[model samples]
Target: MEGHKLGRAPNFTGACIVMFGVNLGWILLLLFAVYGLVAAIFLGLVVNHWVSWLEHRKQLADQRYGDVSGDT
Candidate 1:
């Protein structure tokens, strides 16, 4: 009976390792997805800010020099 139980140890260890690996993979994938979404949102905000600043600068220029296109 002792020998039979010892023989099963390796199989149990292998199953445990496989389960751990699968769980780790899912956890890592979830973290990466969340981080990527946050990054995308941050990038969008930065772009919006730059666009707003540029528009403000254009307005200032137009005010100082008048419309160069003479469109009125």
Candidate 2:
């Protein structure tokens, strides 16, 4: 412990900066991945709505009553 200079090893400042950069990159990458996932979910919902509307319209075209069911 006498001559070790063991507080943060060697090149502490440079190593810290490098670690910070790596962590920042990882954070940005993770945020992008999450954004892509959310976007995908929203796109799926939009596609589902579009398909439902298209099918309803098709049914209306097939019959004059506009795709009505017996329940309501």
Estimate, for each residue in 1-63, the C-alpha lDDT of model 2 and write its tens digit. Answer: 778675754647788879976975675567568786676566556766987999888777768
Tens digit of per-residue lDDT, candidate 1, span 1-72: 656544333347678869976975675567568787666566556766987999899889999998896646
| TM-score of each prediction | 0.48, 0.40
List the candidate 2 regions with Cα displacement exceeding 4 Å.
1-34, 65-72
TM-score of candidate 1 against the unseen true structure: 0.48
- The residue ranges of model 1 lying beyond 4 angstroms of the native Cα positions read 1-35, 70-72
RMSD of each: 25.8, 23.9
Cα deviation in Å at residue 38, candidate 1?
0.5
> What TM-score does prediction 2 earn?
0.40
> lDDT scores for all predictions?
0.72, 0.69
